[model samples]
Target: MKRVQAALQHFAQAVAAAMMAAMFLTFMLQIVVRYSARLEWLADRFPILNPSLYGWTLEFCLLLWIWLVFWGNAFVVRDRDHVTFDILFVTVRPAVRRWFIIISGISICTALVVSIEPTWAKFYILRLKKTATLSTIFGDWIRMRDIYSIYIFFLVAVALRYAWAVYRAVRFGVEEPVEAPAGQPTK
Candidate 1:
């Protein structure tokens, strides 16, 4: 199970890296194409390099960015990687910290689960809306819903993650070791 999870984590990180690479390449293409219009020689040599030809690049980059953010947060980024104001949590006793984890995990899980339905409803409604450039490039098949679908995946992944954390907290007081403040002695 540990190996499987590690494999999944690596796969997810790879996917996120691929998305970032794609976005970078697309952005570079957009820049080159945009500037090519100002360079007559380049434009004449490669008429297809017209700035208008790569109009889809911006939209595509934006689409990839949306997926990258939600997908990375859901699968690639770990809980400890997130920023948190945990001064109170860290100051508390181990038992209180465990309770805090349980309560917060439950709250987060509940919020995410509850938002799923409304999120889906919005996505369903967005199915009718097509991206201006992407739809043209993809033969009108790419809808707003398709682009935003990663959000649903993010919600589900986070809810499940929190649920697992809550379960672990119940079974074994907070699994993470609380970091002591500066000058503080080890408990």
Candidate 2:
């Protein structure tokens, strides 16, 4: 069981890293292409190849970035690296803190479940509509665009992670170790 969990964690990390790299590279490529064209004065030389095309590239790149970031968020939560109000927890008694953590985990899991269906529906609609670049006739679904794929992946991952967190909270009662502040007393 431990090995399986470790493997899953590693796989999630790899997926997140790959997505982030792809998003970064896509944006960088778009920037380089746009700047190169501008430097070469090709926009003036070729009326058809205008700077407006860069706007399309920017939109595509932004969408990719959103997908990558959201997809990676699940792994962030799994690792317990997501943002939190630690100071409040620290002030509470350990037993109370444990209950609070468990309750919060369950609430988040419930929320994720409720939200997933609608979110997936939205993605399905977009996919069915074949949304795509204005210049291209191929819709996102037909082209298998990253936006649709990544959104689906993100929703699934978030649901799974939150579900696991809820399971852990129930089974273990949320006695997970809290990291100490740097230079603080361990006890």
C-alpha TM-score for every candidate: 0.91, 0.68
* Model 1 lDDT-worst window of ten: 178-187
Misplaced by over 4 Å in model 1 are 175-187
Cα lDDT listed for each candidate: 0.88, 0.64
User: Mind giving the per-residue lDDT tens digits that candidate 2 earns over 54-77?
Assistant: 555655666657765776675544
Regions of model 2 farther than 4 Å from truth: 39-56, 76-79, 134-140, 143-153, 176-187
What does candidate 1's lDDT look like per residue over 4-104, in tens digits? 99999999999999999999999888878876778888877877886667878989999999999999999998877787787898787889989998999
What's model 2's overall lDDT? 0.64
- The TM-score of predicted model 2 comes to 0.68
